[model samples]
Target: MKMGMRKPSLKKSISARTKGQLTRRIKRTLNPYYGKRGTGWLHPKKKLYNKAYQKTTFSFWDLFK
Candidate 1:
């Protein structure tokens, strides 16, 4: 047998399935907030509001001024 050869274990397979399910659930939950539509969480509209809330610095002043 090769030193690095190993049989796949049931635990690994189950864990992989569980992780996949969890990822799907998270995606579904966050889909409305971060989907491809223009109204998602990271959408430009939302991002603009976030930027407005951020503390402006000299760099922004130069850019906006």
Candidate 2:
């Protein structure tokens, strides 16, 4: 049989220790603002403002009006 003819397995398995380590790594990466804002702590407000600004220019008009 050719290697190219092999069927892919639909299931993936990982050890519990590996899963725990991955969870720890993710937690460590997210620990800075853990309880305060979760993963979006870095740019939450800026992202919100950018989205709002992109939808309208009324804020600029108010400043110069």
lDDT of 2 by residue, 1-65 (tens): 12222233333234445675787678778875543544544688976775565565443234556
As a whole number from 0 to 100, the lDDT of residue 49 in candidate 1 is 60
lDDT of each: 0.58, 0.53
Q: Model 1 over residues 1-65: C-alpha lDDT tens digits?
A: 12322345778779879996788778979775534555545468767765554433233234556
How much is 51 displaced in model 1, in angstroms? 42
For each candidate in turn, the TM-score is 0.27, 0.25
Off by over 4 Å in 2: 1-16, 33-65
Off by over 4 Å in 1: 1-16, 33-65
What's the lDDT of the predicted structure labeled candidate 1? 0.58
